[model samples]
Target: MKKLFIILILTGLIYVTYLNKEIFYKYPEAVRYTLKNSNELQRAEFEKVLKYFNKEEDNLKLKCAQVLISNIPLYSYKKEPETFNQVVDSIHALKNKLIIYSDSLKYNKRMLKKVQDLFVDKMNFLCKTNDFFDKEEVRDIDTLSSSFLIENINLAFEAHYKLPKKYRTNFNDFCNYVLPYRNDREPLEFQKRRELYEKYSWVYDSIKIKPLEDIVIQIYDDLKINIDFKKLSNLNLSPTPSQIEKLQYGLCRDVTNYFVLLFRSLGFAAGTDYITTYGNRHSPIGHNWFFIMYDDTFLPIQARSKSLIFSDIEKIFKLTNMPKVYRNVFNKINFKNSSINIDTDVTNMYRPTSTVQIENIFQTSNKEDFKLCVFNKKSNWFEVDKNFKLNNNKVTFNNVGRGIAYAVTNSFLEPINYPFYLDYKGNLMFLKNKNLKEDIPFNITRKYPPIDLPNKWKIDRIKALNNCKLQGSNYLDENSFKDIYTIKNFCSTQKSQFLFKKEEKYRYYRLIAEEVTSYTSYIAEFALINTDLEPIKNVKIDFYGTKESKLKQKSKITDNDPLTFGRFLNMKITFEVENNQNVSGFEIQARNDDNHINIGEEYELKVFDKAWKRVRKEKAKDTVLNYKSLAKDGLYILHNLTKGKEETVFTFDENGNQFWFGVSDVNDLGVGAPMSMGFK
Candidate 1:
């Protein structure tokens, strides 16, 4: 009787195990590893997805599921309204209002300001309501539903198989590039990926018969019209496809993310490439763009531009200077130097690169490894490239971009030595101070490089100054003016001088605009100078212009503020000097970034020996700052003590021109001519 009872109990235990077979099923090693890290509920949800795929007999999609499941644990999204349905509706309402205002020429500045204020208020309200927008990272493994995962896998495979044979990528490539449900912090809502596919798939349909490049170009062109790229906050928020479609305002990274998702939605393999910092310290902010795969090769496209040919992209890179560039992939892989698991170095493929070797002064043994870093902020260094091993008392970093300042550091980012920069020819130039006792004369003009806009410098503002006349008159009448000087060429400098001897004593002087284009013109600051080349103080000035230009206060031309400009089609300014005998020349300042040194603003100068040491602190009495002699071959930085944060390190050339070390070393940045420093 006891043996029979034991047999019955064993049978009951076997039945219970068989009943829960699907729940305890095994997955691939990588997928199982992620599952092990997940909670019981998360594991059950993933198991349900696997069982559904297995029962359907969809082996291809089942493999894609494994790829996504293995990497999804690391991905998360912000629990914000950027992906919600209500946000899209709100954006559309605001966009409609914008369209109405933009369509009307009768709208005045007041009306425009009203619209802008409304937009700002709406955005602020939306941002403030969501504390989780930047505060929380909601993991997909914890929140993702089984149905969402299954559908994403199905749609990705469907799109991949739909592509033409020539444009189609291998399974591995598709899985790594196009199959991921989410990249970065994009939203992980149910049916979001499929919704994106359904919406943008039309862009591919009309151009399907065309070559892959043409179709890709058309898609980009259409998207650009629909999505408005803006210089929004540099918060690195990855806008969801829905947000991009509705709001149409995003930064470079946000736009790049949108482009990648749009391309992947239509069955094309696409990804993002970015730099955390530029080679030049003047513009420390980084940039990102999208790339598409064609014939086993990926081609990059600019984020805010129209579709560019492959050659155009290459040419842009040849002119661009970057310390490091990284590509984002779906696979759970990481470089030794980077903590990001999805990044791969692609700097060499974009620009001229070199292998860097430096003495391993900090290394205690051959087993020691180090990080190469770039200057980021005031005394801050950011790690880049790959982690290098120490060998033979030397550390080597490969595929380093040229024309950038670099330093060596441990994992904690503690610097081992003073920073050094790479020249355009891929040579290292050290920054150690050779003469600490001696000071150097420093003349600073701009704290930051002027913002580069296409056709802005040479074409719009400068070209408007062509044939502009400077005149002197003993009388206030315009007819009494005699031409002192006529600008024959574009004045490239923001602050330019037109000097001539005042042969005749003139009480009145006037600067007149000539050959102006319909393109809006502006004059920031204007001044009359004495024979000694000093500005005549307390001069009474008045402005006259065409009727259209009269709407604006033309007095802004002499406002003494570079940012406050008088916009005009045609205008003239007349000033009466108390004495005409001293009049010699006049000065003109164009509309600029206000980066030039301002009189009365305090400045601090520092040079790096072992660390940054203050050399002098004083207020600027002139447009330029003249200091004592500087230490030879030292790294120097100038800071605006009063305001602003865009200062950078620089050295002086033979002519005392500010040679921005990293900026000018790049070939086509058009900043300043490189100096022939006596370094090989």
Candidate 2:
């Protein structure tokens, strides 16, 4: 009788196990396979998470089971038993956290429904594509990956539980929009990248202990302290937490990624908002900043302590031409037509005004109906307004609020990549005439050789001559002159003025770069002026420099000149001289001080051979040091032995023989230049 009873009990136990096979099955082989590949930290973390899940309530486990069974479909996992089991375990682990956190808030049913809907929507997007996976049986592996689903689940629960009670109903439906992990790059398996975030859990824990406002402040402070902003190569690869922590430096995008991931790991809603490029010509690159949901309001957090105002963000960054601004989200945005390729990852913009006009549509017909779709970041693309229709292949989207949006036809869609900001007048202004003549003003300043001239070198007339016919090998020869207009004496003071006689046409003009010095003549700011004394519009003015002066040659500047001023050493203007223009008057200003010092009573001058081996020292008798007897290419030094001031001047004489002046100081004590010696 005892043996018969034991046999019956064993049969009953086996029947119960077989009946609930999906929930009871454990893959010892898969566990061992994962353990063999994982490192000590990964194994420890996985076991820790598994243990936590094992402690969850029976009801929570059943809820997870029901969710997977209803949405995942048994047919989807028929062939991939190992992937199915792993996914089931990961989901259970995630749900365990959700139940624990939700229990603290007494479990709102409305929020729970919203969370489930988000999970289903995200899962659908992930499972829709099989291109990333190789095996047919495991095609849905990406959706099941712990990094994708479980991480998102964790985020959804945190957003719902921590969201203020007032916003519970209005925001409950969109909680999942802030949960997914898709960035600028394509969707990737989170399982492989989970270990990276786990390494930085300590950072999340530190912030989690603080109050809401304190938490935000702590996050900003911690990031500022830890991450240094440095551009890195191989930006295509999204960096792991360990990599970012070790490198300690990254670009704006890389740093923003780090900030978002760090916040998301701790269950805080964070994302990046950026301009593709600045509208203002002053800035050539785009900019990105952290956007955090704080106190039920979206605020832009910068590296500084002060909070950034949305309107001022445009002005502060000098954004003039924002083609499209994008706010990043984690979930996939599905448009009405799959055939139309739109960049769905970009969903939010920072537009605060009505300046962005959507125009220039190249459609088959102007009368065809079109819709402007704006992404809500939740799940669907909401239409802007029915009034926005295509008229003459254009439509102006005025006062368009901040979001990722596109203009679409039944069969086509075009993404608005840049977010346009309104000018002071509250109108979307196209960047037309970036090169308008009114924008650039006339500027004439002294050039080189003699950057400063003595006040005594006075000339009666400065000529505006043009229509040059060049003499052989010399454009400034006496034969090159065709027409010359000599104005009365104006080159006496530092600033001089001249007026062009009425109705003069000129292809070339000449102006003094510097006053006549013993060594060379320097010139700059040669321009063709209009009757209003403004620079003539759009004329290519070519500049040439030479040691020779046109005054001595009794000729005009030539067109085929070879010598051009080095941009770094001197400023040269290059505008085409406008013909048949009359100048009211023109002004020329010399440099404040001649870069070349007069040596007069300041210091004693010395000359050395090119090698600096042979030295010829001389005492300055007057303000100026005469170098007529010195060899060309000689090294020169200025010494104020009394004041312990000594420096080597690097200048060469023309033709191996000429006087050179000191322009700047030098030091030979440490690396290359000379240094100062304190007076004893």
Candidate 3:
């Protein structure tokens, strides 16, 4: 009898070992990766908690264990597992309730209530503990608790068990892509974290009874009409669900976070898709939106849309040049043999798009094909996108959807930092220009001719008139100017040219570097001109420098053109004429504040036409004709109704010939008057 009992015991031991092997092999890569990276303490704690469910009598628990073993890898632990002893104990005490809830046939309101009560009690106990409040890791304890762990485990079990047998092979998809609790950053902390979960569960339970397609539209409508949306600048930080309800407004990111959290809490797999920045010149900024799993495919959801599908959202954003769009996930990604540095904190939440370009700043000599890998979320990096041969230090990969990616050579794995977007034609474009600052010339002016000043300039007209008699030594202190009339401060540097106003004139001028520091002021060239801008010749000039400084004067004024100063003051009117069109003449009349013509204020718009002559003009009427009308009549009416500076353009069409031209401000246009023009 003793020999028979020993043989039975050995047979049982071998059977248990075989079952454990099957369980390990059944777990997917994402799950295994998450568990492998977890700290020793967390792994041990997870093992201890799961041990309670490893029983022969509880088939539900065994099945739940299989589902959980695969799903648990998606969770990222924030606290040391040993610190969750009280929470784990609380969950262990309710193992029977958990088993009952896991059983499809046994799961009912009574069993669910018992399970929920146990979870709530555990949460309350943990919240009151000093370890929970004092530890930095406990900041995310709501997500790290054993109760939450079971919630995810239960969700995974339901999704896998209830799924039709024909679709059981897709169990990994349902576990990984459907029933995860997290998408982006962890949901905002609630004072009663368990209560928040309960409310979300309630919402999920209420709507989950409806058809899958209806759920997304219903949730969108509820969020849009119920919440008072506000810009991100108004919120101090991400708000909890309870806070979001009270505040009634949030930035796009905040709203997206809320959307993702609410969906995940209810057993729906959801995440945020975002653009780091829009590289378009028109409106460049970052954007975020929610994407939920529906009908075995991920689709985008918008708060304002009643009928928009995922494809519609894609078209609205013009995803072709979006640069990079990332899908937020919960699990951390591992890069193997990385050659490029990565910000690990953000890598877990996002994955790359289908097409990507990898640019290497460093040159490598080995001629070999580089391996392109996508982050598995559950395991280390694995090659999914096809490998490419390096050409001109860059490799472009097609069909690489959004995720974290790396380029692996035999020596090391290099991260492809820049995310690429597909163009309208479905070609890859990168975010390389996101940080570039474009130089736009708003009111660009044509180059002006350099002005000239008289050579042999003299300083201190007052001192020279007084026959060099010093009234105060302070005037000669080098910090002081003897003649203030000649000095102008247009720029900080004393060497820049200064233009005199139309009426201002002086025969003797001085250019002195302000003596704030020991420096020499060099006079490159100087010239003096009359009212007609004819250069005044042979003026006496002298310069004074400090002991360490000397003025280096050029031998003759290079810019001696008499009209240079006049031309610099003159504004040139340019016409954007096409098809060899021409303007005969134009008349501009100044207007007074009372809308009456200022008689003498009239001028000819003939800067381009040397033989410009004034033409007839009239006060502007309330009715203004379109340019096409004037074009048909071979007459154009330009108006500068405002008393302030105004610019006007005239267009004309004679037969089939079209003429369009613009003039600079008709500074003299009478108030309410139209400046009329005729084409030649």
Candidate 4:
């Protein structure tokens, strides 16, 4: 009788444990969505759970379950919706953390025992929590990995502040305080109070900017910091601190930091500011210098050089007013000595680099390669052959070779540190004319510890994929690497994905597809990306004009949604540009026509480089006009190309990607020169 009783107790414990695994993850999503105002919703959700558990009846449980299932939708209907989304996200993150924790429980005796305790604690308390969404509404990743992930709203800023004092302060001014609690602490408040004592007591009491002394040296003389720039450059290197102190030959950041440390030791507060170093690579290598605040004034301190100096803070801010980006910009703030190599893992920042900028660039002697080009922010030409004269912003090589050409402009010359993003929708949606930062998230599965009772799986949500083709296949699959968005399969479903890169610019592009797919019917959809900034009107586009086939027709990209569709074709589709500056990309969905598309994949053979002549002008390039360019915003009439439809507004897909072709446009940026391609 005793043995039987023990066996039954164990069985009951196993069943309860198996049934409650999903509850832990469901909570995190709710927490994430409510992060902005956790104080209000957190308690409400808890109360709901308390009420749910004590109802004590089958009818109550059924009613509660129904209520839970509807919670996610109800939150959607509420105002201040962004707050709710964060809750769901946080819950998802926690689930991943829990999973990691659980994995260790199996491998390491010490960690395993600790994890088991956590699971029991979590399970016991979670079921009692409120059912704001579904019984399993919050789960995201496994429970173990999110151990260090910060979920609360303050978590973002607080985590940043926790970095060593050096990193905390080295960040841009925007992240100085982390969570932007400075509505009342605007910088203009100081600028406005420059001279009044009685009217602004608080402002008067504030610490004012101070000045720093410049120690200049004669050309013949040298200080400890005055080292030669040449002595400290090469493949992956940095000058030692002893060298910096001994020679006083420091780069922008080194000199600035030396002065900052000096000021701090003198009982005064001083800090260094960084900016980008241009010309070495196409990317900007960040640089910084020191500043001191004293006697209600701020001044720049360049410890090594005497020729250039910043006299005041107000002036300094105006000179370097770069728009704050979401990623770390500090990586560029080094001097001749600071190194930002990926091997060092300084910032863990990885960006796609092109061979186009490789030194000893390939040159072509063949005159057939005549084409236009763009170099950094400048434009010029190169004489590739007797008749083929090409001009571009100054780079190397008076001649060129084929395959792919790499040209490094001033932008890539410097070391640039920024988060990667894909905004290829190309001005077609709310995200149109907008680029959002995208991080490659891990693919997830339902390896959650098996519960005794069977629980059905479901897709919580899904997002679309980008339609642009980057260098190599982007995703793990390699070929159709371009994906717009991703979601974890909480419940596995046997379905294939249609993948492509999102593009805003409209231009000539190609789709290379392999394999075949069979589905219920035959229909197709295509995404039209216009890289221009104007509205698109009626335009006729053709299909399957590959280097083969009967491919020509008409189509439109309506404002409502850019996913335009067409019938089946054995080959490719081609379209004309209208109502935009220029277009770079398009998408196609083929149904019913197995020859046109398969169930799983399609390839877009892209023509990345091309040349153009403004329709308004004869044969001259877009920016080099016959007369002065337009500075003020106005209509740019296309006088030539009388072949296409009479009234079509050609536009590209973004705010910055295209500027006026007119020379004197207010924004100095103009259309780019044509790129070289084809058999020379």
The lDDT leader among the candidates is 1
Q: At residue 427, what lDDT does model 3 achieve?
A: 46
lDDT-better candidate, 1 vs 2:
1
Decide which is better by lDDT, 3 or 4: 3
For model 2, the superposed segments whose C-alpha errors exceed 4 Å read 1-148, 151-174, 181-214, 225-237, 282-284, 303-323, 333-351, 355-389, 398-422, 428-680
Q: Return the clash pairs for model 1, or none.
A: 439-628, 439-629, 439-630, 440-628, 440-629, 440-630, 441-628
Tell me the whole-model lDDT of each prediction, alpha carbons only: 0.67, 0.37, 0.37, 0.27
Ranking by lDDT: 1, 3, 2, 4
What lDDT tens digits, residue by residue, belong to model 3 across residues 319-406?
A: 2223345555433332221122221122112322344556654454445446554222222223433346566777766544321213
User: Which 10-residue window of candidate 4 scores lowest in summed lDDT?
Assistant: 453-462
TM-score, predicted candidate 1 vs. hidden true structure: 0.79
Please, what are the lDDT tens digits per residue for candidate 4 over residues 1-680?
99999999999998877754444333334333322233454435533443344445533332322222222222211121232334334443554475576664453324333433443344334435444223222221111011112111123233333333322332223221232211110111111111211222232123232112422122112333442233322211122223234333434544554444333322233454433332111123345445544444434454444344434433223222121101222222121222321111111111111112122122332223333121121221111112122344222222221111122222222211110111111111111112332232211111111111011011111011112121222122324333232222212121223233444333323332221421111123344444442333344344442322223223322222213223232333333445443333333322211111112232111111112233232432322122222211121123223222111111121231112121112111111211110100
Poorest 10 consecutive residues by lDDT, candidate 2 = 460-469
Of 1 and 3, the candidate ahead on TM-score is 1
Q: After TM-score superposition, what is the CA distance of residue 29 in candidate 1 from its true location, in Å?
A: 1.8
In model 2, what lDDT does residue 63 have?
29
lDDT of 1 by residue, 8-47 (tens): 9999899888876544445666676667888999888887
How well does each candidate superpose onto the true structure, as a TM-score? 0.79, 0.35, 0.37, 0.21
